[model samples]
Target: MWGRRPARGTIVKICGLRTIDALEASIEAGADLAGFVFFEKSPRHLTLDAARALVARAAGRIGMVALTVDADDERLAAIIAAIQPDFLQFHGHEAPERVREAKARFKLPVIKAIGVGGREDLVAAKAYAEADMILYDAKPSPGAARPGGMGRAFDWGLLNEAPREKPWLLSGGLSPETVAEAVRITGAPGVDVSSGVESAPGQKDPSRIAAFLHAARGAAGGEAR
Candidate 1:
């Protein structure tokens, strides 16, 4: 099982990476996790073959996260077989039972994403007792095309009084300019970013990745130069 916090610094995840350059930038920038989207609707979506190539290149270099949206057994198996991801992020409307089932069936740690717009959303997280980690992302607007990675953020203050058990990451609306405040406000053990570091939709920016990592590290009292 994953712990509630990293042993040293605040964990940073760079999500929606689709190219070797983005992957390399995350590695060089000292990001703790590298995420790839599998949802076809997402602009950052990667095909199985593309995922395989990137996974091969990232082998043993950083932690890999396979982000999916309410995937069935076959889709999960195919992705797992191809990328062998270290973590599976359920970024859809999957119930706690599904999360528990997927974790057990796949023998991989699960990061359950909760869309938080208010305190009511935080209450829903309590039901996911079996999740290895929790990601608090901004809730998508009505009729949004995608679930996450939209660069929208909710009120960080909403988490001020929320209690935590397992490891959790603060996502949505995070960027190089705002990560420090997000970290300071939430005291989150980890942070995840996608559109925040992109030059355009689905295009990861190396410089932005580096800057975000530096800011997050500085906020966490780690080596940030």
Candidate 2:
């Protein structure tokens, strides 16, 4: 929740969480935020009723994030009414103008997710300064069905070459085994995981969830570059 923040270190967000066991696993493990996917195209997508229930279950224990991609105002209105999320994550090809409009309309912190396929994408991320935060995830390959949640990773070295002043979240191809290295390399203040912690697409394994959170916190405070 707003008051229950993660400790002073890297922010760890477990995204695409669907069930109560997985949700509790993240909170008990001291995650800063838990994200729910709203896109139907994703295997991890949740129905409006399901998202509402999960958000209610969080009960301010962890920051509740509603993730969407290229959604219009009418759809967002219904989602906000149902979930009332703490943050809105735009994981689509939303332009800077769209991000600004969403922030103004929702009056909530908006996290703009950029598809990082190359060094040039970092430059793209900087354009949305009006966004409350930025999320750097691997670009979905051409002809891919979705924008993200493919569990593919981009070149982490690109972030080192092009840095931004605003806080951002690092995602893509992160699991318990490689998350420490990712944090060590990028100095990302936050990290988001979806498929990496799953037993299968849309199925969350509590054990993997616990392990990822443990590994992330252990690596959070280290120096980067």
Candidate 3:
């Protein structure tokens, strides 16, 4: 199922950051990217001004990714105008055509998220190969209040048997303790965390962010050929 090895070090992303301290900690902990949630329903969501400030602090020190769910063109345009994030992450039910359209319209690299609960979910990822990257998150159950950051984990073994040609990230219920295992199991080039690094919903814990990065780096170094 694996196509190519990720770089020697696992690309770490600390997501759902809402504070300057958390943002700085991510960079200090060696995170490759930091994610800002823009979905209002999510407790981690950030306003335009807040997001812009956070992005400014990052200042190209690390990749800044804006997470949205099925946002319309106008909203996306406004966000692009404000923060000009390095990447746009779509976590909604956007189709491949929409992914193509959004990429073309914004002229930004896109990371399409796929919710994986079982084998069927892997099939859904096939349609998004055209995307610059794919994020594999746990599927939300029916009537769930939020789409992701639920701190739930799907079967990592499911990905071990799937076919993948594009770079991808493994997310969902990942914490400092389990990130290494997730990387070892899926061989993901990147791993994303939100709730795992939080002391409470929407509240980031800097210590957890540091530990997660350290553990992920160690695991990536110890992987066998």
Candidate 4:
């Protein structure tokens, strides 16, 4: 199956995009994917109409990811119909069977997000192997309302020389200042960020976004001239 690949560096996914300006900033800054939050409880959440308008502006310039958390098929259907996203990110407690079902149902790539606080959590992969992609993120605090975008960092060392055969993304607590170090330590093929580039919850800062991409390029050894 053909999918959008990073042009020349580690994949960078800027999530929680709610505005066209931020989306354009992500594209101009050389991001590989733009993520839209569909979970209403998220401060970054956007209505389908809001997401659609912003998506139109993307216009194939970059990949788009629809992020959801334990959403039912009905909600998923609505999101798919409206956003028409290129990828689906399940950031909640979803079994591999659920991931496979979503893929078969939507015919879109599914990125299963796993929260890891320790090396033991990597075992979760056995159940998510069917997903087209995997995203490793810092585990949320107990009873935290949101699954991601919480600015928590995990031990990058856990992923060092780890046995992961599937395409994967490293996320959580990544910012322009620390992204390079995170990449160097973890050797991630891709990185996903949300609150790290924001001035406030759901608010993306353009300069931060640009600096993140530029910095990440350096980390991935694809430094832009």
* Candidate achieving the largest lDDT: 1
lDDT of 4 by residue, 1-225 (tens): 223335577789999999989999999988888999998898999999998899889968989999999988999999999978899999999888999888888899999998988877888876786798888999988999778638889888988745567788899889999999999998788899999999998899999999999988889878543
lDDT of 3 by residue, 135-198 (tens): 8999999888778638899999899866567778899979999999998898877899999989
Given candidate 3, what's the lDDT at residue 112?
88
Candidate 3 at 12: error in angstroms? 0.8
- Higher-TM-score candidate of 2 and 4: 4
Which residue segments of model 1 deviate by more than 4 Å?
1-8
Positional deviation of 197 in candidate 3, in angstroms?
A: 0.7
Q: State in Å the error of residue 218, model 1.
A: 0.3
What is the RMSD of candidate 2? 3.3
List TM-scores for all candidates, in order. 0.97, 0.93, 0.94, 0.95
Q: Candidate 4, residue 192: CA error in Å?
A: 0.4
Judged by TM-score relative to the true structure, which candidate is superior, 2 or 3?
3
Ranking by TM-score: 1, 4, 3, 2
**TM-score of model 4 (CA atoms):** 0.95
Could you give candidate 2's per-residue lDDT for residues 70-95 as a string of tens digits? 99999888988998888999988889
Misplaced by over 4 Å in model 4 are: 1-7
Q: Among all windows of ten consecutive residues in candidate 1, which has the lowest summed lDDT?
A: 1-10
TM-score for candidate 3, residues paired by index: 0.94
lDDT of candidate 2 at residue 112, scale 0 to 100: 87
Residue 59 CA displacement from its true place in model 1, Å: 1.1
